[model samples]
Target: MPKIVDREERRREVVEAVFRVVARGGIQQATLQNVAAEAGLAVGSVRHYFESHPELLTAAAREMVHRVEARVRAQRERLGPDDDPHDVAEEIAGQFLPLDAARADETAVWLEFAVAARTDPALGPIAVELHDGLRTVAGRLLHRLGVDDPVATEHLAAVLDGLALNAALHPDRLRPDAVRAVLRRHLAQLPGGR
Candidate 1:
């Protein structure tokens, strides 16, 4: 008899290990051996699922995108028809913020991948996809709130990006409550936001 494995679950564990590795160090540290050690599995076992280092990073980055997308979808679904614009903004944008430990870790991994993708050709396209996806989400969220100006969408998207970046870099300066307040404040700056 042999040990049966749940491939998807194991794969997810490997992805999470990659996240931990990237968060602790940077993308350069998320090699097959390190990730396997983080995941508490053998290197061969990780390779069984990912084949190569680039493939592992690619898969992990894709998983991060899917997780963020799923979170945004859930946030949208959870909103009631009568929720206020500020409330909606906070809820949706909150998905991308480094609010707590879990969100901070996720944000760290995202930042690492994004910076690495700037130089790594293998990650460039997915990085663009992640960037465009968030921008599109911001635009759609603004559109739903009756804001048609593309500038408004850029405003919202840039605010989110800045907040996430600062929160990751300066957690003491831009704490969780401050992150929410900054977003709401940005929304209030827009026309008809009040």
Candidate 2:
């Protein structure tokens, strides 16, 4: 009897391959053929999963958002019962920053795909969805931190996104301490700061 392949698992494998190729060689180099090779599957097999390159790229980009959400959710669960929710919120936000190897790879892959989204109509919606998801997460965190002003929370989230992207591009210019300091300063300016 032939072995059965888990379709969902194979799809995840292809998405991960897409991430790896994009991280290593940018979006232009992450062709369907390249992804199929990276995933150790036949080109036809990959095509069986995604009819077109745009379909695969969009799926991979959305999967990236799902990956980040899962990571943050897991970290939140790891927090002790007595742990301050505000601190956890900060940590969750920090996870989006490319401070370490794993996150750096994720950031690199995301940046490449985001640039591609500018010209790829099929991928644009997925990129927008990921952006909105990140914005929502940031807003929720700020609100949980006692930030009552929606405008202020939105601005802060935008600032945080800018800081992370800039820092990821120039690690030496924006150290983790500097990033943490900025976050702390912003929190201090909140309604009830310590």
Candidate 3:
């Protein structure tokens, strides 16, 4: 008899496997064969879920965005309306920073894909979508905090992006606590922050 597999769960597993593969050996190593091996499945099984390598990469990128958005939603739910501006800003923006091993892997994969997307037609649109989404989230979050200056949103996103990249590339130098402190200090300088 054949085994039964939940399609969505299997796809999630494949996406996770792709992350692991990319995290360990960069995006170029996230081939179907490698990802299949990482996921403990046959290449045919991965193809059953994705039509092609580009399709698989697209799925993984979307999955990363979905995971981060889910975390942001959870953090927003925990936020108290009366919380201090600095705390609120940090709480929301912190969703983008790589604060742990898992997040460091996520950031690393994103960086890898973003660079590859520069020349890969299949990944270019996905990269642009993710980039625009980042800006939209930052804009909304900053706007809500009464930060009318347009540069504030860009500044916040830049700070988070730089911090995440640094932490992902140099985990030993910039610890999670240090990332938070740097973020908080940056937010404090904003007009409506703190």
User: What's the number of clashes in each of the models?
Assistant: 0, 0, 0
Give the alpha-carbon lDDT of every model: 0.89, 0.82, 0.87
**lDDT winner among the candidates?**
1
* Candidate 3 lDDT tens digits, 80-177: 77877567778888888888778888899999989999999998987888787777878877777678666877887888889988998898999999
The residue-by-residue lDDT of candidate 1 on 85-135, one tens digit each, is 667877888898898898898898889989989889999999999889888
Ranking by lDDT: 1, 3, 2
lDDT value, residue 27 of candidate 3: 96
Which residue pairs collide in model 1, if any? Answer: none
Judged by whole-model lDDT over C-alpha atoms, candidate 2 comes out at 0.82
Clashing pairs in 3: none
What TM-score against the true fold does each predicted structure earn?
0.96, 0.87, 0.95
Best by TM-score: 1
The CA lDDT at 5 in model 3 is: 90
lDDT of each residue in 53-98, candidate 2, tens digit only: 9889888888888888899889878876587756767688877877
* lDDT of predicted model 3: 0.87
